[model samples]
Target: MVAEHSPLRVGIAGHIHLAPGSERPIADALRVELDRISDRPVHGVTCLAAGTDQIFARVVLATGGTYEVILPALDYRDTIVEPSRADFDELLARATRVIHTGYRHSDTAAYLAANRELLSRADRLVAVWDGIPGCHAASTDRTVDEARQRGIPTTVLWPAEARRADRRP
Candidate 1:
């Protein structure tokens, strides 16, 4: 259990398909939100997936905050595309702690389990969601809903200029 004076442990859930040029704005918004909690140190919790999760981890570290990683499955690294593999590996190495969900595959069940674990350990959740219902399982909206149900304080960040990129092949 965390002590009362421990750094605020903030969990992250966000979209992987970020628009071509939305990263900067979305990251700025995230920085703004995180800065609001400046009274205490920040400890981020993330799956380090490809888009917003990576961005959140970067912001946390860049701002002198630390973060932990939660892997959805043992083969989660294999699921990352070549382009994103470097970021994933880099962030994973810098994590203050790393946890695995004990699943062999990166599937919906594993993702849900990881999300559950993330929420269980976080004092708050930051969702970089667009407020749209997710079209598939293991989405930002689903995690946001779970966080809400668990009554974890949640913050949604969708900048006015932020958009989702087309899904990759």
Candidate 2:
């Protein structure tokens, strides 16, 4: 039975690379959590970055929900890696809406501003991050903290490992 707040508009953010080959587990968990929270289906927004963002968007789409994208920059070259460029192109085509953050360069200020823009439109935030400390630790962690400070309900999925395995080796 769908709850009164079923079908939530979730906002997703995470590290670009999280658990190299274990994206499925995190995606599955997100699916379950979203269902639990909304008591129904859930749609989400993603930045469509190579790792976590793309994976989350795919999961949302697979679950018969819409995936909206807020690109960090104006063009693909600024945010997408070479090998993943084609995939991003296709994903963009499938998005319910595509928002350009109006920044052409890949600067930290632009990225954070874009993150804020995306978070502003979301009711809840779903984040997949490696538990780490410090500002330069992870963008996902930083963004999640920002969301929390703004009183947005955030669900953070950290890999259940002995250490922060999400970090690049």
Candidate 3:
């Protein structure tokens, strides 16, 4: 847990697809929302996967905030896909803490368990995702729901249409 004087600690969740159009806007929105909630400054934690996770981490770092990484498995380098491996490595280097969830590379159960562990520690959750049912990103959805159930606040950033009116044409 972070010190009380430290900024709010936020956990970021989202799908792993890199659909370029939505990524930048979502990252910007998350940073803005986080800035609004913290008197000190906001810190972000992520698994540093491709797509939403990488984008969130990058934005947090860019905004002079701290980032922590909770890896899904002991050897995350071997588990993540190739293109994303470099980003993950970079995040690991920058993280304040890198906790390995003690799972093997091939276990889906371990990954979900790791996700739960990450969610358990956060003061709030910021999710960037499409509101799609039965998606592979269901873990993110589940994490947000579980956080809400535990009375932690959740902010979701996605389904761009709802926020389209605010965008510059």
Best by TM-score: 1
Candidate 3, 14-110: lDDT as tens digits: 8776554766677778778777767655678788877788888888887788878878877667877878898888887999888788887736676
Instruction: Show where candidate 3 strays beyond 4 Å.
Output: 1-4, 136-138, 159-169
Q: Can you rank all candidates by lDDT, best first?
A: 1, 3, 2
Task: List TM-score per model, in order.
Answer: 0.94, 0.84, 0.84
Q: Which of the predicted structures, 2 or 3, would earn the higher lDDT when compared with the native?
A: 3
lDDT of 2 by residue, 1-169 (tens): 3246546778887766554556767777777877777755577777788877777778888878887887776654545766678878888799989888888876676678778877887888998776654455228778888889998899988656312234545
Q: What value does the lDDT take at residue 29 in candidate 3?
A: 80
Write candidate 1's Cα lDDT for 1-169 as tens digits: 4577788899999998888888999889989999886565599999999989999999999888999999999999999987789999999999999999999999999999999999998989999999999876788898888899988999999999999997768
Clash pairs (backbone) in predicted model 3: none
Root-mean-square deviation (CA) per prediction: 1.6, 3.4, 5.2
- List pairs with backbone clashes in candidate 2: none
Model 2: how far is 19 from its true place, Å? 3.9
